[model samples]
Structure formats: C-alpha cells, structure tokens
Target: MESETVTKRKTSNETNKKTDSLDDEEEIGLKAKMTLINGVTVIVGAYCYAELGTMIKKSGADYAYIMETFGPFLAFIRLWIECMIVRPCSQAIVALTFSVYVLKPFFPDCQPPDDAARILAFCCICTLTFVNCWDVKWATAVQDIFTYAKLLALFVIIAAGLYFLLNELQDPVKNLPRAIAISCTLVTVVYFFTNVAFYTILSPEEVLGSEAVAVTFADRCFGLFAWTIPVFVALSTFGAVNGILLTSSRLFYAGACEGQMPEILTMIQIHRLTPTPAVLIMALLSMLYLMSSNIFALINYVGFATWLSIGAAVLCLPWLRWKQPDLQRPIKVNLLFPIFYLLATLFVVIVPMIASPVETGYGCLMILSSIPVYAVCVAWKNKPKWFNKSLSVMTTILQKLLMVLGKSNKPAQV
Candidate 1:
C-alpha cells in the first residue's frame, strides 16, 4: 500500500466532518473487534504516523518526501492514487452529505429525492468551485465564517446534552459502579473509540445520522429549539464542504505543480490567484461520484482507503531514520513508537475486514484499484503515440478553456 502522513484526518473547528460521523455514531449494536485487540490498537493508533505528518511538513512534498525515504516509484504511485481517486471521491462524499443535510430540514417526513439531491449536490460542488476560482481571499472568508458557525453549533449540542444529563439524573454517579464494571471488562484504553459510541453501541436500530438525535430531542423535549438542530446541521455541513473543497483543490494543485500530474493541472486563475483548473476538476470528479453512490458508501470507501496511505507512512518512519540520520528533528520518538503504530494500523485495518468483509471489502478494492491508473500515469512515456497525442490535445483544450478564469494565468508556485 502506498501512503500519506495523516490517517485520522484531524478534525478541528475548521473541519467539522460531523455529518458523516453522525451516521457512524447512530449504528446499532456493540459489535466491535475483541476488546484486547481494540484496546491496544486505540493507544498505539492515536499517534500513528504523526511523525510522518511532520516529515511531510518539513519536506514540503508528500511524494517527494516519500521518494527521499523510499524511491520514486512508490512516491509516484501514492501521489497517483491520491490525485486520481482519494481526493475527488472525498470531495464528492462531502458535497453529497451537504446536499442530504440541506434537504433534510424540509423533507422531514420523507426520504430526499435521489435525483433531485444528486442534482443539488452537483450544483453545490459547482458553486463551491466558482467560490474557489473567483478569489482566494473570498473563499477563505467563506471558510472562516462557516468554521465559526460549525463550532458554535457543535458546542450547542454538547451543552444541551450535558444539561439534559444533569437534569434527568439526580444521582448522576448512579451508574458509575456499572460503568466501572464494564470498563474492567474492556480492561484498558480501548474504550476511547467505543466510549464515544457508548450511547448507540448497544442500540438495535441503525444510526443513520445526527438527525436521530435531533428528532428524538424534538419528540421528547426542546420543541422550541427543535428546528434549530436541522438548521445548524445544514450550516455546519455546508462549512465542512467548503473547507474540504478549498483544501482538496490545493492538494491537487500542489501535486500538479510538482510534476506528479499533467502540467495542465498546474493552472492558476490570474484574476483570482486560485487553482481554478484544479477546483473544476475536483468538482467534475465529485459530481461523477455523486451520480453514482450515496453518503455511507462514500464514507466507508474513503475511510478504508485512507488507512492504506496512513499505514504506509507509519512503515516509513524507521526507514527515514536510517535514510536521513542528520535530518533535523525538533521532536523525536523511539522506533518502538512507529512500530507499534504500524502493527496497530494493520490490526485495525485487517480485523474489521475479517469481521465484516462485506462492508469493508469494496473500500479495500477501491484503494487497490488505483494501481492500474497509477501504472498508466507513471508509464505514460511508453504509451502509444496516438494515445499520447490525444492526451496532449485534451490537455491543451482544458488548459485554454480553464484559462478563462484568469487574465494572466500562472502555474502554481508549488
């Protein structure tokens, strides 16, 4: 498996991927990998490849960084996989989710029209593409506003939960003994992920989305603010989509500028100083994905694919140490750290596949499916002349067409 630095896709105020997580949280049953395996995985996996994330920051090019530690072929394959599948599909997933949330508020009584929602999702991607292409500053401003809105909404939910818990349970510690007993069963830090799923873990029904929470709250209490949950969810989801659009486009742009992708992808809008070509490409790919799959499918696929890169990166840590002994390290860790993480990552990835192959197998295939494309990309030099000519022609047309976004177009600085 090829790799990148980050596996967890660190969420912050700026990236509230709460929409997808809400669905995961709603899943019923306490079904999980054995407690022993899961517990060790929880601790070892927390900092998995964190050092490689640092390496990428220090080295600047994720692919180039990997090349320094490993070789060009591996780096190229990783970049190829990322640019071709991971990013676009990811953007599409987010837009699809945003569209679902956008329509959920109004269609509370029924399922959203798939065709209509797909169209709306496409429009959302198009709108965000233009937002990114119109100007970098304006795109950033939109992101900032959404980030704050997302955070505020998240805090509101948390505060509301805490309030309800306090009011309902006069002896809040009443279950402390039972909790401790259950905790003893898990026996260690493994409860980290399981603990978050505590509420829904044992539930029998599916946890489709945070819609469950909001709906339940409305049915039981807080009727006055019931409408607010849907509204805030829409806002937060929109913010997440915008943030992902901005970042994912930049990543594609950077890959192109570094020559890992076709030069046509290097275009920047002169009028707005933005990666207009990359932004549009992302939108096109996202829309294609929106037309094909639903939210949960995308989520499962993305999560499974991400771990491949993450696992590969963790495996690089020891190699990097010997390969670049003099490399400046403001912070360092023992070899055992990354080794444990690598094993933990494998356990996390493999155990689930074994436990529920039907669900995760498709995602694993999606990740591996990049290999054929990667072979074509890296072996373009050996491709037939006619194919090369056709590719060149398409590239030229796209370059000229996308140049409409700029007055004095320039290649990305890197």
Candidate 2:
C-alpha cells in the first residue's frame, strides 16, 4: 500500500539522518536515482497484479489469487494475517498520519496532543467505515472525490499509485492493464519529480531530519502559506484510508464467501448492496489497533508479511499456467514479469529479516499463529450439529439486524 510506506518513511527519515550524513548534491542525486528505481520496481508488481486480477476475477486481491492458485491453507493464512495485522495496522497508521496533519494547522507552532489526534483518527475510521458499509457506490464516491482532491494536492506537491477494486470495473480484463500502465507511468513520473523537487529545494540534511518530508518542503517553499501543505497531506491520507477500507473489506467478504470466515460476512445490506458486516469488522479491528503505541513499528513487521503474501500471489501467475493449461485467460502476461516480481518480493521479505530480526520474528510468529486457527476453525469441518446450529442462529439474527442477505441468497437487482 502507498499509505503503508507513507507512515514508514517518517520513522525511516529519522534513522537515515542519524546514520548517514552526506553532502547536499550527493544526497539529492542518490535520492533521485533511488526514487526512479523504486518507481520501476513498483511497475513490475503492478503488471503482475493486473494479470492475476483479470485471471481470477475476484475481490480479495492477493488472497483471491493465492486461494485459486495455491489452495486454502496458504490463502487462509494470508487472509488471517491481513485481517489481524497488515490491513488494520496500515489503516491505523495512515489514519494517525491524517489526524496529525489535519490537526497541524490548529497546533501551528506545536504538535497536537496524542490523545486528541487518536480521537480524531478514530472518528475518521468510523466515518469511512460507515461510508463503506452503507453503500458500495458511496465508498467509491468518497474515494473518487478525495482522489481528485489529492490529485490537486499532488499537482501542488507532485506524487502517487493505484490498485484494488478491479472486480468493480466493468471490463477489467481489457481496462485493468491500461489502467495499470497509465497510472503507474503517471505515478512514476510524478514521484520522481516530487523527490527531485524536495531534494532541489531542501538540503539533504533537512530531507533526512524532517518528520514529514512534504511538510518540511512546504515549510521551506510555502513560507507563511506552509499551513496549506498540512491540509493537502491530511486530504491525501484521508483518501488513502478510505481506499484501504474500501479494498480490505472485500478481502473479508471474499474470505467469508470461501468459507474461511463467518458466513455473515458474505452478506450485503439489502438496500445498500454493501458488505456491512465485513466493513464493520474491519473498522472495529482498525479502531482496536489505533490504541497501540507501536502502530508505526508494526508497519515494519507487517511490511514483511504484506510482501510475502503478494509474492505468493504473483508466483501463482506461472503456477496456474503450468497447472491448468487451458483455463480461460483474458490476459496472459509473459512469464518473466511474475518471475521478476517474485525476486523483488523475495528481496523485500529477506532484507528486513536480516536487518530487523525482532520485527521480522514478530511477523513470522503472526503468520505461524494462523496455523492453529486454520486447524481449529477451518480444517476441522466436522463440528457438532449444535455448534453449527448456534452459528446459523447467530448469523440469522445478525442478518436480520443488519438487514443483509447473503450472496447465496441473491437478492433481486433493483
């Protein structure tokens, strides 16, 4: 997620400042090249995802592709880790970033109180959750409006990327690749120039030392108008949170449809045609994670898991080709793309383990923890009828309360 890296960069900047001091010209040149390299690297994954998305035609981006190609156990583990750690933590961290920036102008010469920021973050999450749950159209509308808002902001700052919501596209197989190509190209150009602008305007030391790089850039260039930068960043991160919620809820809904999650999650509100249960559950989990002081640190660990899951999914591109030779492929990518993407994901997953063993260990432990959960809840399918009945009853009551009908019920189209 772009939002994941946005939060990760804050802490990383402090570390870079302490560890490496370089001359301004050398620093700017090095950082510019790194930005270009990073942009190219992301394109590889974008291609891989575009292929998998068209091939699978499912909502849960990585999870859906992995399940179809790798089978249930691995997919379930990915789903579990994503729901429990990656998605929620990423959302919370971004929400915190949003809150901080939204409150920045108000605080002016000082930082906002932690409690106040967190409270606002919670409200942001809840508001978006409601937007997601009440209607799919509403969620996308929020994504679109703020996306334009952020684009205008990015026009000012210059930066961005896109993914998820492929299933919602009318002609994903045809449109997906085009969207990826155009968006990735635009993002790559914008991000590279954005960094160039940063390096050109601010000294290397300032770039490395600042908490919010964009805010610092604005401080340097915007003068008294610097306050507008915070508002732009706040809008940017706010849209990011909505994008994450809009997509992550689909993972939960997809898991339910696959029988890996409670059946109720597969349901949609009758009137709204939205996955209310899935959205609410995701929102609740994100809210819980907001209470953790280690939310930023957890990004390091979850980054490990996130890349791992994505790597596994990308591997499926070739696996399915070899396994199911004649499966309908709306688009077939060259084998080289997935292979290169897998190598990139491998580098991503391994570097952290060597550099940050404790964080990597936590990520590994979290992935392994899903094993017992899968064994008990998923693998053990022969539960007593009473237990099954109890679940069905609860699902029924909740369905009534939420006014949702399971996908299996196939409520008539309006």
lDDT of every model, 2 decimals: 0.61, 0.80
Clashes of 1: 3
**Off by more than 4 A, model 2:** 1-22, 108-110, 159-176, 325-330, 408-414
Using all chains and alpha carbons, the TM-scores for the candidates as numbered come to: 0.73, 0.84
Judge candidate 1 at residue 127 and give its lDDT: 82
Ten-residue segment with the worst summed lDDT in candidate 2? 159-168
Tell me model 1's lDDT, rounded to 2 decimals: 0.61
Tell me the tens digit of each residue's lDDT in model 2 across 169-217: 3347778788887888898877777776777677777777665777777
Mind giving the per-residue lDDT tens digits that candidate 1 earns over 328-360?
A: 654456788778777766766786577667658
Off by over 4 Å in 1: 1-50, 53-64, 171-212, 355-365, 380-390, 404-414
Error of 1 at 154 (Å): 1.2
Clashes of each: 3, 0
